[model samples]
Target: MGKHAKPSGKSAHHAPGSVVRARPLPVRSAVRLRRPIDIWHKPALSAVVALAIPDLTLWALGRLDLILYTSAGAMCALYAHGLPYAARARTLPWVVLGMVASLGIALTAASLITSTALLVVCASLVAAVHKVVCEATRIGPPGNIILTFIAASAFFVPQHAGQVPLHLALALGAGVLAWLVCMAPALIRPQGPERIVVARALEAAAGLLRTEAGTGGGEPAGVPHARHATAAAVNAAWHTLFLVPVHTAAKAAARVGLERLLVRAESALGDAIEASAEDAPRDARFAGAGAEADRLGGWARELRSGRPLPEVALSASQAEELAGVAAEEPGPRRPAPGQPRGVRAVLTRLAPGSPLLPIGARVAAGCALAGWASMAVGVGHPYWAVVTAASIYQANTTLSWQRALQRTLGNLLGLLLYTALLPLMHLGPPAMIALALACQLGAEAGITRNYWLGSVCVTPMALLLTEFGSPVPATTLIADRWIDTVVGAAVGLACCVLVTNRRAADRIEVALGRVAAAEAVACRLLAAGPATGADEARDIGWARERLTGCLVELREAVEVAAGEWWQRALPEERIAHAEQRGHRALAGLVRRLSAPALAA
Candidate 1:
């Protein structure tokens, strides 16, 4: 179709009979350094404390050789740091349990089998499971890396039937400690996680406002990325609010306070849409957007600090809606009857034709191939290669390639750092313990800066961890790790190239259908609204949220499919049309439900 011609049909990403091919890896972007994440210190500090208490206790008992089990458990602290406390409370125990289970399974297999080949296969399967389950649970950041690392490492450890239970128990004990350490902050600020997320939503909304708040604005000029960020942040803030418990008066008050600020930020979002969609510069309803942006930023600053939440006088309908929200709080929105719920939801996500399943298959194939290649290359510990392969798999093929590149570079740099630390590490367990803890701290604290930076610390830490059990020849160990890194990165990329994700293309169609369905529901709710009651407004808001979520999912599916190396040509035009329509409808619903909530 010509530029000015009406689009008659969806255009596939590529023409029929054309072969899909991989693009150049994102080498520079993968390694580039950036600022730390907002909660970087939480997981980093929690890991340090989690490891220290158990390590010191083990040392006192003269059982420092069992550091692997404890370290495995301690790493559980790295997960769920991004979750609200209410969710974290329920999630942390499961994470700990999963960690222990992974350890137990690996240990049992190792004890029963003497074949390094069999062991590698078992560990690779563990990595695959970890990848799928962690994604299903939405365990944010460092997702399956820690789980795979623990399982793969355990697969090579010398274990007997007698030792498996004890090891798992040790892991469980230390994981409990990590859980306590992670939850400690709740004692002082029960709403801390909610506050941070709410602040982030406000800040993101303010960012969008500033983008369009220009004096010489044309079409309001909000960047796509800024709008997307605002939408995601506001969505996350509401999720956190729902997950918060409100049985007590104090907790209820705190939730309502945060909800008030979030309501204002969401209103700013709605106004931005109204202002941009109508292209009316002099519209009075959108005139207060700048003032709203300033309030959002100020409220965000206050939320971030230890100060009280900013007070807002919600109009009557807003108050009634909030009161209803409070009444409905302490749980996630219920799924409709006959729809997948809880475990079923996870299973549904993992069911046939799901995009994540292909990635899991990729991990299994990559790790196995990398391990076999490492063994063929005569590396002593093929599991290192397995772990490296597992770490490289990300959400899509392109990201996997970038991680493969980054991991390779980071491992080389990490080996150099290990050599430098080798002398200090020879000072015995005490010095080794301190250095390992320091590396743990750096890995968590700096990972948000960039994955490659975290790998730099991780490499040295892994080498030091080995010394805890029994000293090895530094040169031999270093040489083996170097070899494994090369083999793993090479083979992992090979698997990614060879094992194509054709399902990714199909997912775009499913996502588009979901978006259409959600949009229809949103349209119905919007037509019925200027909701008279809290329940009706809540219904409109829910419809809008579902529609927005479906749009996000559609975008993700399209992006992932587009990045797959051997994917069939996706219907790019169809995806764009669906997303544009879905988002436009969502913006309309936002105006209807949120914009006037704080107009006073």
Candidate 2:
């Protein structure tokens, strides 16, 4: 039997002498609340470019008042972040179309309906769709909440049916401009995004090696965390590379070479895992692994700069070994089996059993309740309440709580900033436009660093946007905002508790099952000895890839489940066992590949 197989069928198998430390639930919660920030300036620049072109074009046409509609369309530029240029080109247009579709629905509903209740219902549906689409597509941060916020707010704005078509056309036109701005970066460095992703993966691998080497023996304390980081980087690198089609033979060969380098990086991680298992000496492994990692990083930089590949002193043999492995079993060129492909596939995946459904339900309920509550309490703009509620719903309850706190605090400080700037913004249309632009830039620049800091800018920009139509009393706006913030956040959090995701633990179990199945298949292949045919080799390769993918999914599930407030106790021991056994299986494959060379 495979080491990971359990007779009880509850606990997973663990490698000999491997101990899985069980962290206290409180400690896990506290640790997860604090995530480090990685700032990428490219997206900030992209936002500015996207917003500027349309705003300037409208100003030149003496129709600066239409900038609000253009700004709505410009928000589409925020999608497809971290994607390769080719992928962004395809994704941005889809995002723009989706945005336009949502806006059109909101405008048409607002024009036809006079009752606030019906409008709230319509907005809730839009919020639910936005939530599901964002989660299903993995659009990452500044996600569907923003889209929902804009669309829901549009529902409250009174509009004539005659004006709806022109507004929709404006959004579509601006969306095209946003798409252009996002794709412009590819002109200067076609391969830059993929290179940066691979380089970061190499760096993460180096960090893991260094951490493991410092521990000297047993499973390194930081090995799991470092491994998680390396896995994410490698996965991202693969996705980026896969998105770009290699039309020319030269591009194809170059892509294959880069993929081989990525495989070498993975092998280095496997070596570190094995060394940690066997109590290899710190200095020897560090010296060898560190040199190889640095060499890969340097090569990544060259690739980014479009320079010729440089020869490496330390990794030459390892590179040749990886090449042999590649020849024997090439990595997959497409997404793994069972991944969603088309619109139908995506819809099928988001059915009732999908984990994301509850999240979408929460957004819908929270936004609708908040809007109704605000209206009942006599707040001037109920959409602010809806937007606040939508923004606070995250992947789990714990994150939602944190976001609520951040949003409330940020808005308070933002109110102060808005008070100080109201006088300046009243100067003229140009002044208001420029200040709004600055706030947009600041929000984009700071959002990745801290949500609260981004909120500071977002709050002011939102306030100024209201002024584009007519000037209201500053004091009245401020009072309504304060009341709406408190009401929305309270109602949003209430919904989080009410709509509990009891299936979080079930999802974790399912993920563990996948990890076990994949590991078992790989172990069986290893036991059957070396491959007798290309088909056998390919099967082994696929099994290993599936195992790796399952492990990543398992980690994500465990983290998300740990953060939920009311979910059942997660199978931490079983999870640890599965992880340890999965690593051992991978290490076993690595040893088999290198055995003949070591003996010779």
Best candidate (score: lDDT): 1
lDDT of 2 by residue, 1-600 (tens): 011111222323433123222222222232222333433467677777778787778767888767667877888877776777777888888888988999999999989999998798788778888988988877776788668877987898779999999999999988998888888878887766676677777777777777776675566558888887776677677667657666665666666667656665566667776777655665555657656656666666676667854433223333444344345323335545555666766786587788888998898899899989999999988888888888888777777877787788778888999999988987887788788888888887767666777888989888887877556799999988888998999999899868987666678888999889889987997899875544554455456567777888888877776666665545667888999999778766555543332310
lDDT of 1: 0.79
Give candidate 1 regions above 4 Å deviation: 1-22, 215-222, 282-288, 329-341, 595-597
Q: Please identify model 2 stretches exceeding 4 Å from their true place.
A: 1-39, 278-287, 296-332, 337-345, 530-538, 590-600
Error of 1 at 98 (Å): 1.1
Instruction: Please give, for residues 116-214, the per-residue lDDT of candidate 1 as tens digits.
Output: 988889999999999999888677888999989888999998899998888999999999988899898988977788899999999999888877665
Which candidate has the highest TM-score of all?
A: 1
Q: Find the 10 residues in a row with the least total lDDT in model 2.
A: 1-10
Q: Alpha-carbon error at 135 in model 2, in Å?
A: 0.2
TM-score of 2: 0.88
- Output the lDDT of residue 264, model 1: 71
